[model samples]
Target: MGDQFPPDVIYEIFSRLPIKSLARFRCVCKSWLKYINHPYLQTIHRFKEEPTPIIFQLVPSANSNKNSKLCKISVLRVNQLGTITIEKDHVLDVPYKGWSHQTPVLGSCNGLTLVLYEKTPWHGTLLTLINPVTKQRHDLPPVKLRDTEWDCPSSLQAAGIGFDDSTNTLTTVFVLCKESFWSPAGINPPLCTMVHRLGMSSWREMPQTPALPICDEGVFAHGRLHWLSNSDGFHSANDGRKVVWFDVKMEEFGLTDAPKGGQYGQLVDLNGEVGFAYKDDGIHIELWVLKREEWVLRCRFDLDRPRHIDVVVCGCWNDDGDILLTSNGGKKRLFVYTLKTDDLKEVKLDGRCEAYIRMHRSSLFSIRGQNYK
Candidate 1:
């Protein structure tokens, strides 16, 4: 009986169970619910239990009559025989009508996914923090920028979300570029930066910004938000793209060396560390993982992908440690790369519409202490 065991023992048992089981047990009693919701227990459970790899597939809206876009979220289950199965969990109907095949997961940390609400002629760009399992959504206030004062056209160039362990807070960083055609000669519009805390009411501008323009997506790992830059601003001629990282706690920007390879590279989260995968040639794909602040070669394999399908390495599936790959090129396929066997297996996804698959580390816990309203 739970009543006989000490609270510590009960906490340990509850922390070891799957998130779903923990959620169910929360209904057992008020004490159990409080224990499960405690910050200490939540952190222990998160570190002790591996987060399951979930796939977020963007497909046509389920409501045939509506012109809105839909996102189908599913959990991936892999058995010992390497057979993969999908279990549908949730579906999100994006209210916007101008949705494309582009991925909406701007950043994700601790089961919280950050999505971009594109700016329109009427309003500025907005960010939202969503927990698919909890079905809780936090729409961030409009990003504050000085470009509006100058009446310049500003676009969201890069965005990322990260968790600050020291502060126990979730933070988001944005990079915006403002262009004014009537600017004086020899003066280019400066890139603006904004930083926001999860429960904050508004976004605050960062004092400085990355010297070079950051690529679209950013990967959160090791208490920092990282982005890949194609510009040759910081790196020498020998190095291709530069890896830029922002410390969520320190609120500063730093640069790290990227592995030598092709011009285009993708950043992924391997467990809790950062991983980089790039194509050396048209056929060979090289993956490097960051260990002890150093980039170590994980594996290399020949990838025979569909024509025009741009494959990006989605992090490893914690169940079997197999590498998951998806394409941002709007293809409804998932490539599971087995490291030991050195084989690439394709998992065809359902739905006739094109899809973009993203690996999400999910939990069933609610996102407490956020400004949901």
Candidate 2:
């Protein structure tokens, strides 16, 4: 008999193996290595498997000294099945002294983090893309919007990072504008947005959108960068809540309208799909999914009255997904939701301080279906 089994049966078996095992099995033979590293294998790995859970450190109030010194970084592998563990307390390490409060931990792509730091004096803010796990950091130079215009001390800036697998390069994009010029004045500010590709020493100005309220959170997924827009109240004529997506490959911005019937919810990725959660009548928490240009309500869970749990949606897949929601109002207790069974399980963590969880890479593997087994 030939050394190969049916390709369909091989895929079925491989789809169930964890990424670590698959990584080791890549050296089984030349054919095995070739099959595992194939582009098709990477595609299946990217979309088929469940990612490890990571936490985004949400520091307590600025007045709390005990928590102020803590570095707000993302923690991975807090929850998983057997044979997986997260030994490190924090994923990324910042060497700077003192705390940069609310510095904004943007999304992480390809083992790197897009962090925004506020510095003093002429350079008001610094945008950095660092590989926390690898300790490799790239600091982007200051972006000039106009020939004479410089960064304003009072203005707030937001940034995001995305990696192009095709080119194996990372890109950082920043949007800076006057803090007070958000309104539709007769003369709007010039060059409100700028983008900088890696290895370039300077920033390039880009066309600005029509003054939408910027979001506080940013994430990168599927080769694009996304952020929530609070432009609902920008102009009396415009709707209030919208989500904006910036395509890193194409360098364009597009808006995805919010669900028709929700208020005060956060946007997150659930198994690859864009997910949202909102508290309805303070009694029920509803999770919604956006797929193929339609918003569908997926699951709902009842919350105890006046408990005020902080819910943060992470990522999803088809009918099942994951959510990291804090139950104790102090960020001490965290719970994960499995949409398949609509079950909410409290994540038992070893650390006492508040922790953050994010979704890492996923893949597929087949052991017994092939000749190696």
**Per-model TM-score versus the true fold:** 0.85, 0.69
lDDT of 1 by residue, 153-266 (tens): 246678888888786788889887654313343343467788888777778888888866686678888888998874534445566777889999999998887887645678
lDDT by residue for model 2 over 82-132, one digit each (tens)?
622343446564432223445346566654566654443365556666544
Candidate 1 positional error at 49, Å: 4.3
* Pairs that clash in candidate 1: none
Give lDDT for model 2.
0.57
lDDT of 1: 0.70
Off by over 4 Å in 2: 1-44, 47-49, 56-92, 96-103, 132-136, 142-154, 164-168, 179-191, 221-223, 235-240, 316-320, 327-329, 355-357, 362-373
The lDDT of each candidate is 0.70, 0.57
Model 1: lDDT of residue 221: 87
Considering summed lDDT, which 10 consecutive residues are worst modelled in model 2?
A: 364-373
Question: Quick one: best lDDT, which candidate?
Answer: 1
Cα shift from native, residue 176, model 1 (Å): 1.0
